[model samples]
Target chain A: MIWDWAFAFEILPVLARAAIVSIEATLIGFALAASLGLVLAVVRIAVPWTGWTISVLVELIRSTPLLIQIFFLYFVFPKFGVVLDAFTAGVLAIGIHYAAYCSEVYRAGFDNIHRGQWEASIALNLSSWTTFRDIIIPQAIPPIVPALGNYLVALFKETPLLSAIAVMELMQTAKIIGSDTFRYTEPMTLVGLFFLAMSLVSAVLIRSLERLLNRRTMR
Target chain B: MGIRTLVTLLIVALGVIAALATQEAYSLFLPGLLQGAVLTIEIAILGSLLAIVMGVLAALARMYGPAPLRWLATVYVEIFRGTSALVQLFWLFFVLPQFGVTLNAFLVAVLALGLNVGAYGSEVVRGAIQSVARGQWEACTALNMSRPQMLRRIILPQAFVAMIPPWGNLFIELLKSTALVSLITLSDLAFKAQQMNQNTFKTIPIFTLVLLMYLAMSLVVTIGMRLLERRASLGLARGKAA
Candidate 1:
């Protein structure tokens, strides 16, 4: 396990290439989770019958492990003639799993809204959609942004699970490179470092967003 | 009529439908899947037991130990809490073997999950113990009770009762987190479902079964926890009512 600068340099480019895939998966997964979570939350809160059903669905999704979901989607779905590329399946599974959590954030945000706002909206005879858009959402979203951002960082760390399903994300690439070179140290260390760096950056970014959102909300 | 009841009924209907649709496929994999489910339960229960032990020890160490021990406990808590459990699982399963300290998948999964959950649980334990009134501690001391005796008879009992809700939540989390062990080839429910999917190529049916099983497991845990909470809170409930 001697540090070989030459070996490190040789593998750096490959590791860097794999990082792009990891980032893409993280971003796509985060986007899907955020939007889907919002929809699930809104539906759960806005429509009683649908809300209860979605609540159970979300809970089931949340209680089960993401690894199983990813494997199911990636390896099983194709048997049903619904084939997704590894990358697509990876992101979709991650997104769907995290969406359950994100929905809780949204639910909390909705709960935090003042009761009077709902009454005021009803007094004005505003439709549910209009009332939610103009009044509740604007008030609900800011406080939750930081929590949601934290989940994004969490989602980034989870990208490694994608490798289990053979998505060739950063960790997978490291495994590949390590096995190829008969040296696990360099690639695995680099992968760990990559995670450390990305998580640090995201933490800082989320903290700043929290401050900015707080300042705006205070006014 | 409110939408809540309607939605509940609909979701229940959907769950029943999903289970019924998957009945034939589920029967085929039922034996293997149930064995996996047993493994899942074992990991969940054993991991939770380990977590409770570690959590109480770490919490005690942090509260009563020397400054250096406190710092060590703090570092342990922060590192585990800050990172993803999946990474910790990977490190335990993959990296430890490099150090010639290899463990089977089941052991590694339990250790990793226990350590991770213990980190979180320690905070809850510490908080619950601290929330016990100052008067209670003072009264024990005034009665000439030794520190360990006081802790065992007074402080810990109350703290343990208070710790139930948080522990319940963490148990649910631990149950879910156990799924990661399948990555290392533990034949837990997740792994079995994946195997069935690979063998039968019946994706929807297999996964539908997995989802329902998980839901049922979690529902049972949740219900049991609620009953425990109710039993523990009986005195408080009477006081409040009076």
Candidate 2:
């Protein structure tokens, strides 16, 4: 019941090892979400029909809870004869669920671009790809970087849900260590501390990025 | 007319058909899913109510209360907002028990969610109240209306209306966050899906059904919210028009 430094020291290394897995999942998951979200946003904007479909798909994904989605993917895919490792399944499910929200962020970014910019791009007879890459993307991305960075922090916190599917991430590793030692206090507390530390770091990093982006924009 | 549309249609059609073909399995899972749905609704409704209350209190305290009370409220908001809900949930459910304050899983889930959502909702509530025109407050003061009376008669009604859309979205987010409760052994919809998958070993169909059921629930909520928003905004529009 008391604060035990000895136990805390013992669990810190184990949890830190598991923390690496969490960091990996978060980075890969964010990368997947960012790219896929951008593609979905582009598809939705350029083609009306595609937009409608993507909207529906995004809403469907958003409406459902992520725990269910992760469960579904981890359990269901193997039945269809495509078995993924726990880590891959966890990352994929998290990536896919978050991509729906990121797509919304991207859509907002796209919408916030002034109509004049689009008209000008079209006026120059530039291809859609060139216009997006050269003008629209540069303008849209700055405002969204903060939002995307927030999602990265969000995705980091959500890595615990991977424990449910047996991914042995930080939370799962902590749970294992706790159950084995019959001492939940140290491991669980350490996990909470780890999350708190990482979240604080991410928040500070995001604020600095926002400031940097603002300075660049002002110039 | 184009290949992309055709491909999307094909994928969607296939997903739906696959969902329907496993109708019997859905029947088996429906009871559990429905139970989970009840929990989901309970969490959304009760958690939202708690959040609104906490949000209003926090906002009011920050805006008008004593300095220490304002600091307390600000600290609460920052801590909850800066942390993840999942971590908060775990700390509440798992760590709190070690302190001999063993809350039930359902209560733990509700408290964790309510507290987290309350932090976000406080901002919405605060902004909505602040955005009420300064002239309106001056008018109330000239009328010699007491502070409480002015708030009740003039400010809150308008603020509540403005808070609707963001609150609606928050309700949806609350609905989704309820799934995390399954981790603490709450038999919510997500838990049921996991159970059904374990039993049948047919993961895809059961989950597809769950996805559709969730979609149906969210769509219904969205429609209801939209109607309420329209009704609220219509009153404002009519006032403007007059």
Off by over 4 Å in 2: B1-22, B142-146
Q: List the candidate 1 regions with Cα displacement exceeding 4 Å.
A: A1-13, A76-80, A196-219, B1-24, B130-155, B238-242
What are the fnat scores of the candidates, in the order listed?
0.41, 0.70
TM-score per candidate: 0.86, 0.90
Provide a comma-separated list of chain B TM-scores, one per candidate: 0.87, 0.88
Q: For model 1, how does the per-residue alpha-carbon lDDT over A1-219 read when each residue is reduced to its tens digit?
A: 556778888999998999999999999999999999999998887888897568667767776678778877787667777889989998999999999999999999999999999999999999999988999999999999999998898888788888888888888888888677767667766776677667667778999999999898889
Summing lDDT over every window of 10 consecutive residues in candidate 2 chain A, give the lowest-scoring window.
A47-56
Q: Positional deviation of B188 in candidate 1, in angstroms? A: 2.0
Superposed on all Cα atoms, model 1 deviates from the true structure by an RMSD in Å of 4.0
Q: What is the DockQ (computed on Cα atoms) for candidate 2?
A: 0.64
How many Å off is the CA of A119 in candidate 2?
2.3
Q: What is model 1's interface RMSD?
A: 2.5
